[model samples]
Target: MLARNLPASQTTEKVVENCPIVMGFDLKYARAGFTVMQSVLETTPDAQFCAFNVLHDGLPDFAQRLGHLLFDGPRSSITFIDVRPHFDHLELFETRHLSRAMYYRLLIPILFRNAQAVIYLDSDMVCRRNIFAMVDALPPGACLGAVRDNISRGDRARGAMMRDVMDHGPEDMLELSLADYKRDVVGLDNPDRYFNSGMVFFRPSEITDSDVQACFDLCHAPRYCPDQDILNTIFGDRTHLLPERWNYVLTFPETVGLIPDDWMRHHREEEEHAAILHWPGPRKPWRDPSVPQAEVFLEMGRRLDERLQEVAPEFFKDVLPAS
Candidate 1:
């Protein structure tokens, strides 16, 4: 951990009845947030959804209209936090699938000092769980609760190299192995302990400026999965590792046979029971038709377009399901 100053920008708050849930995204992915949030709302309507402008990307034009039509658009709803000043200076780390927005949730503790507990969800997630109840189930004094990622729980051999663009092609892809990098940088002693940053609940109690500084220090350089690595390094032993169902990674061809065949039957059942389905890495279901649950996610976008077309036809001029 190191010492650093938190940004002085004030957060915009809109009061909600239940749990305060935070999501980070820019204008490009704002539509994805709408589809994902609407899907979650279908299951759990009381959950408060906040759009975090991590890069100070101005509010999406459709937000005000959607405020009145759908979601908690009425008064005392949908808190919007402007975190532009905080991240504007940094050279953001991103891959083909990830964006600078991936780094936004790291500063949640510093930005949201008032909330009792904050839930951070990536825009790419689609879920059917009562997330608020999940927050309630966290053990006392639990700072955070998250699922073990595909790497942490599924396989350790896959950790040998990161499947990411690192200014290196296939010729030198294994130059810096992920497991070796983690062991050296964060002193990662236990291979099974690394947790993903995508879906997490933070019950912040005494998070100090120093802890926030540690987040800043970690991102000073880019790794394979920049934010995921930083969060694992900083949270260390504090993360309450939930079951694999909390954030199950949708299987693609490359990931299908990796899990042993004996457990494939169990894995299929696990998929049906997954609380939140995550489309991690470069290939996203919304964009790539080959993904396992691509239709399930695209259907969400189609449904979102249909409703908006009925009420706000202008919003769907470009069409929601269109790539």
Candidate 2:
């Protein structure tokens, strides 16, 4: 493994204010998706939040839909931009989803240029905590911060996914593991590292100073999950390991003896303000109905969906019932 030394205290120096410039993006098909995320920000009085989407072209219809959804004045905080000119490479837009790539490639730069610090989240996440406070927790100059992924479980899942999707041979899968797939192949070592890309935060300097570019270059070469792999590689050591309270994934079994039941209920009820709830697996609220957290997630999804439709009727057709 390659290691680089950086200034210890410099990485801990706070550059941005306590508030974070929150961001998330949605592809057009997600259906009023980003709007629900924006609602949390609008309701949050402490943090300065912004939601956006990067379209192939600036579709007027979608813009109108966004306007209606955010008619309550937070529209000023939301943006719909075209990234075609800003990022000319098609390969850069190929992984995960373009909306996600755009979040990193385009928005990260803009954040740096603005001299702001922000946490970039995926649209699938639900905000349950005070986001700004979560950002404030990062040590100053820390290039990135995120919760660690459950590696033992993630490796089994990733292996199965590759076998199911790519028909990879057992040997190929084994080789990937031997090559430190969970580490080098995946961009960082397991246990101490390997975080889900659903949530990440960093200062603008990290991206502006070639760190982001370094991650991008490594990702494009092998064609991996662009966001997670790139982030793991770039902020390997610099990332602050925040408590599970912030970006809690619903994978830990009840037997883990961790999060208290009452707190789980509070987070589910949006009472604790848990920064974000990441349905980090395939069982998304609107798409997968059998998820153990289905009922709670569905209720939230439906209410938000209805709210969006009432305001932006044309843009948000009924979200397809948990396909």
Candidate 3:
């Protein structure tokens, strides 16, 4: 159990004693998920024991095996929650990068009601630093915290689409013209601050039922990144943009030269001191280890494979097919 009385009104430099981290994944990424958990345990060895709330589709055998492996160590406690029931409402939406959008709005709040704050990390990422530091540094009154998106830099079309839906209504989003999304949706007055939803530090207590419903309603609208877009639309103003080091997005070597020098410098710094490595685009490390810096992810996967072979050979069947 976690402390639930943390104040949600203003910035308070205080850190919670016990922070709970949550992650959502499907069977397709179970191995990656295990690697992520293992990395966190390995990196934050000194932090007091933490709890990991893993939300996944119900698979008895896989869940049992994962439980045994994760619980074998005393550094963390694991709780598995089956999210199959939430699939019904998501059937109409196209699940491009996300397995289920409801996991962000509905599932997290419910599962972490007792927690004052929960760090929600995508299973595809690996932890490189003590995540509790971010949890401790969370700004008060903010519903969500995340790193600024590096890929969304010049793409102003997304902002335009969001503006269309907000101004004319959800039905008009697709019909809107794409002049400049960043200037339109993100607002010219405010700094162009779009965040990547891959790694989020959420204050579940601050999110209300109405906010969840608003997120669900936004999901019905036509958007490129549904859950991410909805979250930005709803909490964009209240979001606390953390330093990029916390959620460093990886880039490929071939395309690296195409980006601006400043961007390259930022990425290099992030790579050097990355607390979490996020494989954002379609080219993931598992699919193509030839990508620069992919060795890190591949190493984690290799370690997970070895552990699976040793403790639970049956679960090894879930490993990705040889490329």
Candidate 4:
């Protein structure tokens, strides 16, 4: 579907094939959301796509700004929908306090209405390979698919934090880490199970009508990462991991040997390949002026955010943050 508002000269079409159509959202991550919308608008007018934003409060000014950024592309045919109106199914979790787990509930209703299967991605990510390949690999009755974390960094090194995060002992660290999961999460019967939730494909039919809400309720109980835990609880064995290239988290620019010099070059290369680029840490290229590769991400933010300075001026400010 295309955006509701677009320039008169622009036109777009929907093309469907053997695979299930794909859907994704960029909720709180508005910058990445707009970038994703632009990326999709650039490449895939013929391919079926949908954009979700749960936080839209229906304010005219907010809606107008979002529409201008997302839908007014050169070849625009993108549909941006606000799912806030249909909050009835999971009203127990208000949008304001919506945890990452509860945040996923609105998608189920959208998925149920559109296609049997859909892949949801976090806004911080950039996509390299075609996402259709990832969606094609899921088996029937499965609700999710993803790639394993690219770097394990080894168990012992991650032990201190992982132990505290999972509340497990040294012995259980391996199990908790699922350091072996890439080898065993799917019972060792099917090898494709240890994907990172940063990128995932899900089939709503596989999720019980009540399961989405149940997962949200589970969030208040106990958790390290609410989203991951809810997904692990709900989808479990049905989830599969795709290859890593689909959602490469562009690591801090320093590690790539470019440091000060190659930052922009690497950032450009990543942007070209990525279906989505997941900027996982707090050192956002937009907000951190000190980062060597800050320019590209900063430019990206300028395009995505209507009020870049107001929302995060430190992002565009010439001076770096004080230590």
Candidate 5:
């Protein structure tokens, strides 16, 4: 199935033979993506890793080199596909937190048509466990699997008139009443149906090229959280909500009072112990080291710098230091 919105021009350097575990990001987050790759190499060393990178200011030199590092017989291979031309033409919504790269996961079906499934991840996440095990448990006929954005889910069920609101979520939005917005803009009554797009198990066979087109078409409208809105609108109903540990957004205690106690009760696992520690929001560990989970990313980045130094000295010398 040739996805109409999928990128046709790609520079490939040995893509994986089977369904790949993919991550997409622009050049600005190349370091962040590398940090994620480092964590995966440390924990899930055997996983098939591919990066659908949007290039700017030339190729991501260090990121590409780390992809070729052969540990235990392709224990970790990083394949990169250039995804610039596909999205460059569109004036998609974007902000300090959301990049155009966030929308690239929609291309999974077109990229790997024959594969049963593919894993997609945001660049800023820290992987502590082999999440492939979770995919094995995905129910037959499920189109996609992801953790519910607890903060997003709870707000819909929230009784209080005033509550901490998430952008483009179940609240008064774009001058529409809370009821009308959720029903109209989001096209959902039950917030439980919404899932964070940070990490996803995308089943290519369950969807079609039009689903991919729908996602791209949504990009025309500007919103606070563009890619997320597109995803929830297109794929929410058929989604299988996974265990929270897979995405563990890591916002509970870090930014105090951001997450309500009741929400915490629903998701009991602590952030540090979770499978994938994802630090959303603008203050990333690299930019602002004071964030709660910053150390997890910083320490690994320090080590990643060392690993790169060992592999290719001239390019990565004294880079990737802890913030």
Candidate 6:
């Protein structure tokens, strides 16, 4: 039986009093972070929320305003960590849409030393269920728990793309051939079962400064997805594969056709019960209102707006229309 289908009575009822959820964001992704945090707070209601801002230029002001809008009566508190100093030595990879802050996710263990375990989420994702349920399901001895990157599993071309990035040295990324990537990068016998780094239940004790440093070092290499590549390289086999419902990645019909049959069947079944809805790729629900899952995000945004209007109408007055 899938974890998502487990009745509420059977689900673990442990109240996660201090479960810390760390999210990375910048000015560009501030709104997405708010939606993510809002969704989590709505679902968990009692967990601690922390935001790590990679851009320090106006973080203090943003954090103050965000706190006033989100944290009303102390049901949950948001902690803001300025990660500018950490980014000084690290490389920031930026494409047209993706930001450098995505790489900062790997630094969660180092940033929050006191936390035994931390939940790291990309700002583009929204929690649809109580995340503590996933946290409680972490298997023993596993350093990290995450869902398989079904986008890669469903399509051979996508798998090859991942291999191209992983196998080639930073300087040789463009020279990739499918045969060489299969034979040299990821072994032929090993199917590409890379997990998405967007939503992770991580045990901080399993990570070390050296591990963090190694990932950062890999960032300088010629890689397509920096943090994701490092995570797949380091914790690929060590990670415990969680159910797809825990991190249901949104996809369109065209992409869905590319996914393998078995994975597709599983995706269809688990999607309805998804605990977190992850908007990967360029089409974010917040940005493009036409997206299939746009309503989910928009509804959450509306709910947040109403809450803000009730609690702090002055702050709500400055709210910009969702892009």
Residue-level lDDT of model 5, residues 13-54, one tens digit each, is 233445567877655576677778777666543334533332
In order of TM-score, best first, we have 6, 1, 3, 5, 2, 4
Which candidate gets the maximum lDDT versus the true structure?
6
Which candidate number maximizes TM-score?
A: 6
TM-score for model 6? 0.83
What C-alpha lDDT values do all the predictions have?
0.63, 0.51, 0.65, 0.46, 0.64, 0.67
Q: Compute each candidate's TM-score over C-alphas.
A: 0.79, 0.69, 0.79, 0.59, 0.78, 0.83
Candidate 3 Cα lDDT to native: 0.65
What TM-score does candidate 3 reach? 0.79
Tens-place lDDT digits, model 1, residues 66-119: 533555552224555667788888776555655667787888787777777777
Writing each residue's lDDT as its tens digit, candidate 2 over 216-260 gives 565344333556656776777777877665676654443222334
Pairs with backbone N, CA or C atoms under 3 Å apart (clashes), candidate 5: none
Worst 10 residues of 6 by lDDT: 1-10
List the candidates ranked by lDDT, beginning with the highest: 6, 3, 5, 1, 2, 4
**Backbone clash count, each prediction separately:** 1, 8, 3, 21, 0, 3
Residue 197, candidate 5: alpha-carbon lDDT: 84
Tens digit of per-residue lDDT, candidate 6, span 160-262 = 5544434334444445553344335533334455778889888887787887777777766555556776787777777888989888887555655677777
Selected candidate, larger TM-score, 1 vs 4: 1
Q: In angstroms, how far off is 81's CA in candidate 2?
A: 2.1
Looking at model 6, residue 83 earns an lDDT score of: 70
What residue runs in model 5 are displaced by over 4 Å at the alpha carbon? 1-17, 45-73, 95-97, 153-173, 177-180, 252-262, 270-273, 314-323
RMSD of each: 8.8, 9.2, 7.7, 9.2, 8.7, 4.4
Clashing pairs in 3: 156-181, 159-181, 160-181
